[model samples]
Target: MVPQNPGAAAAGRAAPVHYTHRQILEILSGLMIAMLTTMISTSVVGTALPTIVGDLGGQDQLSWVASASLLTMTASTPLWGKLSDILGRKLMFQSALVIFVLASVGAGLSQNIGQLIAARAFQGLGVGGVSALAQVILGDVVPPRERGRYSGYMGAVFGVATVAGPMLGGFIVDADGLGWRWCFYVCVPLAIISLVVMQKVLKLPKIKRDTRIDIFGAFTITGAATVVMLILTMGGKEFDWSSMWTYLLAAVAVVLVIGAVFAERAAREPILPPRLFRNPTFVLCSIASLAVGVAMFGAMIYLPQYLQIVKGMSPTRSGLMTLPMVAAMFVTSTGSGQVVTRLGRYKWFPVVGLALVASSMYLLSRLHVDSSKLVIGADIAVLGAGLGLTLQIMILAAQNAAAITDLAATTSGVSFFRNLGGAIGTAAFGAILNNRLTHHLTEGLAAAHVRPPAGGGTSLGTPDAVQHLPQPFKGIVLEAFTQSLQTVFLVGVPVALVGFVVVLFLKELPLRSSVSRVDQAPSTSPAPTDAPASTPATAPTPNTTA
Candidate 1:
């Protein structure tokens, strides 16, 4: 008999249900569009940042352009997931798509860098919502034992976006009159199309709960995250790292985090339930996700920039350069998902994957301005292979470890950390690049004995515009930019390895064949076997794996 889980009963009365392959695919078709829409919205701008900043004249705030969206996405992820548990999944999913479409409009219409960042921040709210719910809805239908089959499809969608976004952005930016704003505009049509498709295709067993939304928990957490992001993205650039304002902001962040912890403890339907942290799988997966986020976004956002700025490649060429990495990601992510489904084991994927990620980052650090296209492609391919292995597996492990009632919470918790890592990583790496670039540029220019440009320092411009700089100055600029990028890539090595170490402690629990936690099989294979039997999602021993 399956052991009774009190937590499952307390959350909501879930009806046991399942869908056929056709039905599942139909639902996924719409979900994939939404996923593609958001994923494209992010990467499409990776190659466009220089042009965006050049047009708006806020090179210092360039990182904020990306960080603003990521910040809101990270902060709002859990709230979206938790709310879906209380509200209807279909209702929540559609709402997010609409929000994303409208925000895309605002982003495209923006005249200033500040306006664009604001619009992106709003867009991130929808991004956070749609991404979390997509996974939640998947859990509602696909049993943990079989989730890998569908997860491969999600990985494929992600791969496509990674490939298409940059290439499209490059083509648009390079094409006359289309401009970088079109990058934001391109996602709107896709999002609108997905909204209608999801409305008709997606269906789920609704769990209606009368519990109050954790407004306090959400507020404190959002506030804390915002402050931390401000410090990370702004500290050295906005003010000196050791300035009094930095200390004040740090203290405020600490207080807000403490408030969030207390609020969550008291909340009836906490945005992030304190109980989920008790599960070792959840905790370990969260760590791995956070580290991976740092490494993944750090690479994705910069590789294209490096090619365009330092190597003097057109935006289109830069986008094309990333194909190897994206291709590897597609193959490995799909392959790993299938392997996990067939073998019923996932722990090794992450342990090995994260190691690959760290090694890849090291390989990237080794790149110079003169590195061959073959070497560059091979290094990033390693990164793609690493990410493909771990990205979906971490979430799968977390979901399988959770009670069915906690599915939404578990999925959101992992996503929240990953986005948080991305936001901070993007900003931190940007700052690292900018800081090193400033120093190297100054020194290189001085060594060259070139007079300072009109703006006093190196006047930032689009990749094409930068090509117009005269002789030794142009040569110095490439060397300095390449050197700065080296630091950014090297810093990522330790960060990804931190994830590798944390994942080692993540014990692989048996996958569940049933969709409901309360209906799991009683028997569990306690030893290694060709196919270990499924296990019940028991209440885990707090802070202990056993």
Candidate 2:
């Protein structure tokens, strides 16, 4: 229906009228750069670890290399999202990009493992914003119907990064006079460019209303998350799982988490509005995302190792070998997104995707030393297709459920749980792999009647020293790695199964109208019975709350 007074609607506009195509591209470019930075840093380190550990000095810190980044990102995601709501997306995105760039430089220059880990932690904080806020900004710029196509673009960036990161990292690590440091250095300039692009192009109407940030709640949540993750990282590796120190730390973490809940409940402008939990669609999507994270990241982190150690490929070769999986993910993510947009229902995609992923994980669990490369590649591609379907679909589902007012928090909440699941999955899976590897290494050595090596276990610092060993010892180590990796895959199959179950329960909702429709409240709907009965034209559509 035509507005009786277009001037009144125009005058009541809360923010800028619209974004031009140039502006949208500019925002997307910055987001792509941010993702490129994250994927490169994550994948590059996997290939460079041997060289890095040789130079830096601790095998134990190897997991921390990745965990450091996950720790910071998982813990700080909500704060970044919440802060964007208060301070504006442009500021948060720019600040995060700058931090990541600076940290990358610091990481490249680091002389020791401690310094490197510290730098990675700082870098996580920066990239975390990009990871969480990119969706938030997209929620502002794109409607749920159109979002699937753009989300596909984001997935393609991720796939590109997975391929480029390891290949470039391997080349850099092996290059004359370059070494592993260049892996960290290469992404710094790109991050700087992303920051510049965001500053210039990411213009949107800010919430001009008064806002108060929940500083205490933010601190408690971060502190609590960090404490728990720290315990996970250290327990069973640095200290016994049953030790008093571990117990004490775990207790403190529980206390802090409880405190954080109460703080959030009472705070003004809480990081995660508790009400998001009340929506069944939001709750189911978040659960599915968490499980997907556990399955997705836990396997990706170890897939390259399976190729390099068990299959005995070089780092560069391993990177190339993993290409099919990444490529499949890119194709399926984009393809499934288009299908969902056209079909306007996402439930079937996740259900089918998780089932495929579960099947792939079961196939992966059956891998042994004699497994064919072609079969392995096919298995990985299956897993990737599952991932491609589930990961971004969950994000879009959450966005569709939320009202325009709570878009940032809703998108960020989905990301926050996915990352949290990843953090928990990576740590737990790493611990399980370590235990299984140790057990199998001892068993294999006993069966071969050979003495176990001094450093008989897998840790970040496990040297190429083993890489050069003779006879049954080398064979035994390879056996241990294969068995351990297979066990991890076995565990992941069940997790994916859980995701399948959860996705099955998710309700499909109609994709909402455009962002413009959300912004301009409709002037027609049924009036509340408690109020005076009104004609359709005089009634207003009910405002949606998160």
Each model's total of backbone clashes: 0, 1
- Candidate no. 2 TM-score: 0.90
In candidate 1, which residue pairs get closer than 3 Å at backbone N, Cα or C atoms, i.e. clash? none
Model 2 lDDT, full chain set: 0.78
Candidate 2 local lDDT, 1-546, one digit each (tens): 111233433443343235555666777887888888877888887777756866787655666777788878887888898888767777888888888888989999998889999998998898788899998888788788878878888888888888888888878876888888999999988787777777766666554434578888888888887887788778887899999989899999889888888887776567877777877888888888888888777776777667766666666777777688889989998998798778888888889999998999899999998899899989988988888888889999988988776688788888888888888887777777877887887798789887855654434333355567677788888878889888988988888888889888898888875754453343333432222244222322111111
Once superposed on the true structure, which residue ranges of model 2 sit more than 4 Å away at CA? 1-13, 20-23, 453-463, 516-546
Model 1 ranges off by over 4 Å = 1-12, 518-546
TM-score of each: 0.92, 0.90
Which candidate has the highest TM-score of all?
A: 1
Q: The CA-based lDDT of model 1 is what?
A: 0.85
Q: In candidate 2, residue 298 scores what lDDT?
A: 78
Q: Measured by TM-score, how close is model 1 to the native structure? A: 0.92
lDDT, residue 41, candidate 1: 94
